[model samples]
Target: MASNTNLTPPRGLEGLDLLASAIIILDDDNRVVYANPAAEHLLESSVKALSQLRFTEMFLNADSLNAVFRQATENLFADWRQDLTLERSGREPLHVHCIVSALDKPGMAILIELRENVQQLKLDREERLLDQSQANKELIRNLAHEIKNPLGGIRGAAQLLELELPERHLKELREYTQVIVKEADRLQTLVDRLLAPHRRPHIVGDVNIHEVFERVRSLITAEFPSGLAIKRDYDLSIPEFRGDKEQLIQAVLNIAHNAAQALAPRIAAGDAQLIFQTRIARQVTLAKVRYRLALDLHIIDNGPGIPPEIQDRIFYPLVSGREGGSGLGLTLAQTFVQQHMGVIECASRPGCTDFRILIPLP
Candidate 1:
């Protein structure tokens, strides 16, 4: 047993620490005897604190889960596997695939493991997102390249025609030339933005993510001086990593800006809320690469959530939910984060939208 463990975990329980899924041990009486570190995160409590309560006390759906535990204990060498929704107070319900098996060992009568039911689905979705992001960036860059040459020609021709206009019709015809000039310039600007991510030099340096968060927080607060509330829950233990601070700031700011825009109605009623939360994630997998530690930054907003139909495609270029939106905010943000070898995922419901950015740490 590890000397620092808050609870007297049984011998050999140390093996459980390596698993990514949550694992808990229950005595014959269904009281918590041990919980691995992953379980501590899932339950949001320490092993010592959880030891005081029975396993059933941890969840709203305890009765049914306890029934499974009882069955496993009664039928020696028996095990059960089933999908379950673990509803806990003050937190979101978890949909997991639960397994309960009778353990012959003393003090640890039953072994219970909970794995996210959507684990496979999440992996597939992440792969698809990466593929889609890559294709979108390539297409945008190519299209911008094709558009750039014609735009210069159109603008220059419009300028030349404005100068060459006849004296009699100069006033009327020159206005039409000016329109062409302005519209060409606008499209040219748009093309430049499309190529910006690919063309910009990626500057890498030591990044303290909290500093980035504070910068974004100040920007949002200044923009929405009233009604919107910015709340922060920072994990001060997060270590500095190598990344581009300015790019991170821009990526976070874009998401926050969109969140503030979505909170317009709630802001008007003086109840808008946007929260910034940071935590140190352990043994996380990002972009198919596993890292011992990673930075988990979540930006949450209490606003009318993204429309379900467009949620899946929100990262695609020019996919905006708001009226008059340019729709490039999320696409650019995703691009910048990807540049840092990280992934950004969004989950939203009617009253909440959570944008999580995961970046590997040193």
Candidate 2:
């Protein structure tokens, strides 16, 4: 943190230091006239050091900033750039949304506000996802109810029709009835599975995220015993939180199972790998609420990534990238996590796919 005791802040901008957004005031020459505390933190430099440098030295996209500053100063209006990439030397580039406005003060010609675009996008996406999940759950519940009653009747009618057929003369006819009965039963099972999460009462208990990972790992390993390798990188310091242990286990299992299935080709060639990593996420905003501490659990797979066409909708019910996939696995997992007041997100490329589940700690 930078000390403001020795420096005199510009007039009419004394409150810049109190803002959460990084703010920097620039002179007509595009030099740093003032840098707020948040700006100092964001630039990884103290106020004194930043004051000695030009605005161009602070950001790689200095030209874009200069353009915005020129426009604001000349037009005396506010201008903004969305999703601008700010390059830092020896550091990763930051995606930011910047706002520039003419300061209308001597020496301080422009006020620049920079906000982390990725974090804002994540928060916005999470809000939409949470809303979509709730709507999907309600639809599933209603659809299950509409299908359950008729399915039982169809199965019963098939059984009765089978019994009516003569044993020897109509054996083929009886087999047809058997097919109807079997299909009806299968549909019934599907309906039950669709409603399973809502049907069960949530059972809360102390949940160690590592235990959930271990259970999922054991299950996935047992199923794909030959080629795939399951790796664990855990943060044991993470404290236990309140959740339904069984539900969490099932949620993680679904994700790992999906990854294993996706890694089938690599597994055949003996190069498939699944990693379970855990860490403590600080100051995370999940589902619109900010949490000081959250558990960040990642299930990473070295497999062909999720198909781009369906990647965005992977969490929706009945949306699958693979053939004959029910697509309920991710939906159920999302619902389970939401029940625990958490959120899950994914980032994927050609060879690496990461599914991150974040849950608030007690």
Query: For this target, which candidate reaches the highest TM-score against the unseen true structure?
Result: 2
Give the clashing residue pairs of candidate 2, or none. Answer: none
lDDT of 1 by residue, 1-362 (tens): 21122364467666787788988888877888888888888778899988877888888887877677877888854679887778899987777888899988866678899888786456667899999999999999888999999899999999998888899999989889999999998898889888888988999999989999999999999999999999999999887889989999999999999999999999999999999999988998776778998889999999999999999999999899999887888999999999988899999999999999988886
Worst 10 residues of 2 by lDDT: 1-10
Give me the overall lDDT of model 2: 0.86
- In candidate 1 the C-alpha lDDT for residue 156 amounts to 97
* Per-model CA lDDT versus the true structure: 0.88, 0.86
| lDDT tens digits by residue: candidate 2, 242-292 | 899999998899999999999999999998999999999899888788889
Off by over 4 Å in 2: 1-96, 99-116
Q: Every model's Cα RMSD, please?
A: 12.5, 11.3
